[model samples]
Target: MSKPNGQEANHSRQPLLEGRSVSKYFGGLAAVHEVDFAVYPGEIVGLVGPNGSGKTTLFDCLSRVQDIDNGQVLFKGVDITRKKPHQVAHLGLARTFQVIRVYRKMTVLENMLISRQWRGETLWKMLKPSHKDTEQRARELIDFLTINHLTNEKAGNLSGGQRRLLEIGMSLMPNPDLILLDEATSGVNPTLIETIKDRIRALNKDQGISFLMIEHNIQFISDMCSRVYVLNYGQKLAEGTPDEIKANEEVIEAYFGT
Candidate 1:
């Protein structure tokens, strides 16, 4: 919401999302090894890596989609390492997959409404705060995402990019403190990428929602993020401003052959 206060300050404050010495093992293989990462409020951090470098695995660990072998994940200022996926969502954490996930049977607005999973009420009372609140929020999100025209359209009938926008809208329905977007621009048309980026920026700027995004488009990364983290073979090879990453020899070696 506010222009991230700590960034331009003399010293940086604590991170909103902190992964401390996080490690994940799958059948004796260390996918992520003792990785320590952090993301601050109202900040967008790009996570890049080669295939099988455990980018997705690390994301899974943060969202609790997969169990970690060691280490802890802290959100805000508490340990959420052992929390379940739904538990994490209740804690104000939300995420989107590399592949879009939406309710094909529901309308675009309905798809966004369904993302409000934990409003907590009986079936009859659900419509009071849960349903009505979700509807109001979804309307605002649909307009924000510039997909209000498709509000009543069935989600299954929308294009790939529209569906992706719907998924993002759903993630925002709960007003999360942090959002993990695996690849927001993965299957969308080139024209829609800019729109998606703009919406993300708006949410970060207006709502103070933090973002930890995984993207392959270097140009998009340069345009959208304030800082970036590069992972190679499941290890962090570099982290800094876009210019710093662009000039790093190790990142160059990993992405382009020496």
Candidate 2:
């Protein structure tokens, strides 16, 4: 619960991820328009906006899930605008979707195993004894997320919150430098929401993983984020500590129309 380092330190350190004037268009509509964003190393930054305010589109553009029509995304000072999603993941950037994308037919253990195969290991190589380390790491993460009891259960049979936990565990498999989470607490039960929040804090504190999260749950964002960015009509509306965001008139209007 102690605050992380100040924004002064964040500004001193080069950003782990920077989106410079990034834009993405769907035909004539601009889903995201020339938005400048940054997530400093070891900081939990929040992105919030009304529905259709382009928060998710901005996330997609930054994560390379959707190609941008203009601007560049830089990760660790390298331009990753041209990188494919897998390539981006390989560069220590990982993300979870608003809609959980777990392999339903696969068991919890199988899902964890597949996440560890980020290097595109061949089936033969995966089945070899060399993957013991990989399997062990998977088990460790499953235990860390407290889903070890469901290791052999079908992912499809799990509840919404369980699937969210599993997907978060899978994202951590790559030991990513930064994780972009889109509505991570949505539809999750109150108890599980606290669990997800605790895991996020633990990851940031214990493992030093940075996070850029998009959430509609204001209380959740306020609880976890050190800094927050607001978007309205595909444009940057405000950026500051959560308190400043709560007081900003522009942000107030954006969410609760004047």
Candidate 3:
């Protein structure tokens, strides 16, 4: 593996996830074409592209939501290009979708508890007093997300922005090393967008979690991402710091026609 950039690779100092020359197709349409991407143990990488530029498709391929026609994906230095979604999650990789996903009928705490169940705790213990440790852990996570006040509220009752925050919080239940977020604040009211962004920043700073996000909001990318990659017509058009990306003529043209 080639060395990461000049900076110290941080806590674990490892590439939590990597994609090499990855390509994907859907009935002859190449959504992702020979793209290389990586996320280290403590960093925020943004993926940006226009409507048909293949950002989300590449995300799906990275998260194992779809199989790639060619190329390799590595997690913790192991090839997981062929692993199932559940298998990938077990390896400490998790993803949040473009659309919020929660058990609408369940309370916020219950929704998170359901995800905790898959983290190796026994099903029978979920209700027994023996599950105190498990429930306590769940409470801690809810508190971390600052949603503990809504623990008993039904997930369906959350505002769009709040649901987005909860979805990210739930993804953390398994304590993943890398989190793939597809438009974490899409469809949210502007007032709550900054709150969500702040939480993400805090997690990355405090826990050293790696993030790979696909988003259309230019301000979001400019404000939050340390590095940004722009794709156009299924290929990378530019990759650099947010300032460099903002100044790139190619990226400017891709998002807003000349």
Give model 2's TM-score versus the native structure. Answer: 0.94
The TM-scores, one per candidate, come to: 0.91, 0.94, 0.89
Candidate 3 lDDT (Cα, 0 to 1): 0.82
| Candidate 1, 1-258: lDDT as tens digits | 323222221127777889988998888777888888888776888898787778889999988889988989999888899988878887888888887889898899877766776333234654575577667878988998999999999999988888888888888876789989988888899888979988887777677778888999888888877788888877788898777899999999999869
Candidate 3 lDDT, 1-258, residue by residue in tens: 212222224545657788899999888888899998777777788999899889888878877889988999999999998987777888888888887889999999888877765455556767788567657877887887778888999999998888888888888988888888999879889977988887887777778777888998878887777788899989988999888998999989998899
Which model, 1 or 2, shows the larger TM-score? Answer: 2
- Candidate 3: residue 248 lDDT (0-100): 94
Taking every candidate in turn, the Cα RMSD to the unseen true structure, in Å, is 2.9, 2.1, 3.8
lDDT of 3 at 12: 57
lDDT of 1 at 223: 83
- Number of clashes in every candidate structure? 1, 0, 0
Off by over 4 Å in 1: 1-11, 118-125
Candidate 1 residue-pair clash tally: 1
Give the Cα RMSD of candidate 3: 3.8
The Cα RMSD of model 1 versus the native structure comes to 2.9
The digit string of per-residue lDDT tens for model 2 on 88-116 reads 88889988899898899999988988876
Task: Give the best candidate by lDDT.
Answer: 2
- Local distance difference test scores for all models: 0.82, 0.87, 0.82
